[model samples]
Target: MATSNRPNAPELDSACVAAYDHAVRQGVFDDSDVAEQLALGEAEVLRIRTVLTDLRLLIRGEDGSATVPASPEIAEAELSAHLEAGIIERREQLARIHRQMRSLAPVYRAHRHLPQASQSVRLVEDPAAVRRELAAATRACTSEAFTVQPGGGRSPEALNEAIARDTTMLKRGVTMRILYQHTVRANLATRTYTRKVTELGAEVRTAEEIYERLIIFDRSLAFVPQERVGGRPPGAAIVTDETIVGHLWRMHDKMWQSASPYDPRDVDYASTSEEIKASILRLMATGLKDDVIARKLGMATRTCRRYMAGIMDELGATSRFQAGVRATSLGMVKPDPNP
Candidate 1:
């Protein structure tokens, strides 16, 4: 028979191997009676024969009754040779992938540090360009990254994408700080996203209010939103100048100092809703309508009205003005020159 290339060939039964060992000690073996001696089927006998041949354990013999003894040294050498070949093959494949990746590194770096990107502040209006710049900066970031997601909630897909990106950064030992609006406490997707990042040693906090979206890579550069006015599409400002980065970092530090910790276990919707209603009460006392308050808090008007109705009912007030007075009496709303 001929040798085979399989590294994990069909297993030989223990009793059959013992029988082979006995035969090897006798310096010869009769393979024809192997099934009868081992109480195995013809298929099992054939499998053992094939594995022995592939391992170079069975020496040559034309007739089954004249088979030669096993050779352990030759079998070990053959297996070692096969393992060596597999290792070499894997190393070569990795080398090829590394070369391909290296080819793209220069291009990515060139775009990441373009002349326009080198400017004090770049006004990038295209969404695709904004994403490209962000991806480039994130890839280049070494020590740390910080982000502020001001809107209340994120889509499940967006949360998954963030988890994948931030997980890689965390694995590379990058420190991350993320700030969210207190409204995120009511958002399942946002909570899931923050919980995952927090588990990776990223600091997460929530505030009643946070500035517009910001992403800072290390202490070198920052990205902040360029408002969408009229009918123009929204964009971001890529700030590379040191002076601007310092200004932005200081603003972030101040907010982080004031933001509350995002405790994943605190999924108390009722308490969060009451707090939101109290905020609405204060805002309503200031004469902001339902729509304005809803817009200010990044929630729907109907939902805001529901909270307001609950507040009004609790105060036993028939009108907004009465509700304001009753809330003030209940210490839910304090009078202020700003309010």
Candidate 2:
């Protein structure tokens, strides 16, 4: 391969990234190792080989075995150079998009001024409005209700309130399913409520990370958070659109099947934290921001950050990404079977 640094070199694809990351850790890996480790096909391996070679990350051997390796430090420097070139190109595109947004601002404003009844979506601001919307949706649920509640644990008052609503819904023959983080398994109040609902015909499960807070009613109505306007109070959306509501319901259905069944004995379970750690490792490996991970685990941002610091310290990592990479190489976590 030419040693020239060419501007036209292709950007690294996901396979190439995996191979590169593997190489950085293992120092070298032959064709079979790369294929087996990354689960890549022949064509993908070929592409990854070409990209790694062009980036000066791997040196081909005459026998197609025992390729010479590049030090990770040097490879990372080269990676930075390649990324800088790509960023320069993308920045121009972003600037043009921003200009277009400026041009369309007035049109957006005009639509915003339209009467609320005209839109199929209902935007509820303020805590009371959100609660009312949710209550109304739950009451109207005829067949099933699925909810993803991402947060550590509910307060006694909050759990009582939720139990009252959920118990009624369950008794009315509405099948209730809720998704929670493993952390909630340790919360006494939450577990108590979880047990009560499960006995009342509600199915509860937990996952490592949840996407967002949502409630889907009878596969017809769905409620989701609305992005808050600048300095405005937080709010949510009551989605009535068939396409959107169906999508949300399907999402909940998939996550429901993936999550572990809520076990009563799991209260004070040490393995639950391990599961949460594995999820954090997986999410960290993919470069999710801390706040995003916190929301998924239903934990406070501060708590999440502290937990990561502890993990990184234990791993002797110099940075968060390095901690993630080390954890990945160690197989500290397996991919969630359903996700």
Best by TM-score: 1
Q: All candidates' lDDT scores?
A: 0.78, 0.79
Tell me how far the alpha carbon of residue 98 in candidate 2 is from the true structure, in angstroms, after superposition: 52
Model 2, 136-203: lDDT tens digits are: 77787899898888778878987887888999999999988888878888888998999889988888
Give the C-alpha miss distance for residue 144 in model 2, angstroms.
0.9
**Candidate achieving the largest lDDT:** 2
- What's the lDDT for residue 105 in model 2? 75
Look at candidate 2 and give me any clashing residue pairs. 151-298, 152-298
lDDT of model 2 at position 163: 89
lDDT of 1 by residue, 110-155 (tens): 6655455555687787877887877778778899898988767877
- Candidate 1: clashing pairs of residues: none
Off by over 4 Å in 1: 1-30, 52-140, 225-235, 325-331, 334-339
